[model samples]
Target: MKYKYILFDADDTLLDFGKAEWFALNKTLEDIKFNCNKYIAEKFSSICDKLWHEFKLDEPLNRYVQINYHDLYYKYSVERFKDLKELLDINISAQLLSEKYLNSFSECGFLVKGAENVCKQLSLQYKIFVVTNGLSHVQKSRIGNSKIKSYITDILISEDAGCAKPGKEFFDYSIKSLGTSNLSEMLIVGDSIITDIFGGNEYGIDTCLFNSKRKINKLKIQPKFEIRELNELLGILRI
Candidate 1:
């Protein structure tokens, strides 16, 4: 199927979020007068990943509480730091640490190996939009400093959408912003099956799974297309 609009996920899709997260986590820990080791940082990653998955679930299996709409990103992100603080038995304020992490992460513009090439090449033929479950300022700052910033047509963040991936409200905002009623003419590509593939499939649009790490898609969901590399996308789209 031909696609005029290609919505890409920022973290783990184009941006090297893992490295950026490591850098940010270390910086945040340092701010608290603590040094971060691989184990400590990985623990933080695990905690945040679980919280992110919960954020995407329909009922948030583990969290049955009412959703907090105000400062959605801050609410969701600070919770991860709260969990991390408890695990580390730290006295530092979770809110302050989370803010520091965001500030540090915003300075990161590290791209995946072929990200610039893919975005640069695809921008010529397709309307490229970054669809992310992230803080607006952090994402914008990271992208703005990157070379592909010029290639990106725009960005849609959950903070702005007031909803996140795997949720219909977010997809509704995305579709309307894309200004295209034809689902067949659009595609959503990302490394996540839950957010990108499952969400796109549920929304009646084509989905492409970018499995760069070769992780197993344990979920029942499947994407319409899959590629192991960003450059491989050029071949799939016949660019």
Candidate 2:
């Protein structure tokens, strides 16, 4: 096989993080005696998604959650909660809300459609690792509780590596930790163009974009392979 190892992004790529976040955020808001609705969940996800993308690029973001640090550690997530509190006019502290949201989130784990079957099939011939940018405990609990957990060789999270994706430091740390120098033998598959595709491209490895959303108009860089579904990988790998 040309590729001996596969680095897959967890959220959206394999796990249904949208569903997890919706349930967790609603539960957290309800816990604080706030009316939880779809609008609130949508707004919250927008804020968080922007903050994280900005943080990854080391850009100053929303005033409430802006930080000089680039790591997507728990502290950064707490800052995000601050943004959430300010926007939603919540009475609770950011730290308190962060705790509530994370606790609720960790308990909610659901795979993207075909994720389990895809991972199981790929594991038969290649080393598959979940390369993700997320809070350590949250990623651990979510992934550990999922059915795909058995197929994954390991979950490589940004918090544990001290750097997130789209940066050379993160790729450097991940590659070294994986004990591999031949970049050609590995492939990166993910939903995020910036994080997974860009990072893998910069690292000189083949990248496959799981464009489940099919929004391809804004791609700054092109990946080596593209698939609309996990099952398509069977043809790519000649499995």
CA RMSD per model (angstroms): 3.2, 3.7
**Candidate 1 overall lDDT versus native:** 0.84
The prediction achieving the highest lDDT against the true structure is 1
Error of 2 at 96 (Å): 0.3
Off by over 4 Å in 2: 46-76, 79-90, 217-220
How well does candidate 1 score on lDDT at residue 68? 38
lDDT of 2 at 109: 71
Q: Candidate 1 on 63-175: residue-level lDDT in tens?
A: 22212332544676899999999999998888888889999999899999899999999999999999987778899999998889999999998767877676677788898
TM-scores, in order shown? 0.84, 0.85
Candidate 1 structure, TM-score to reference: 0.84
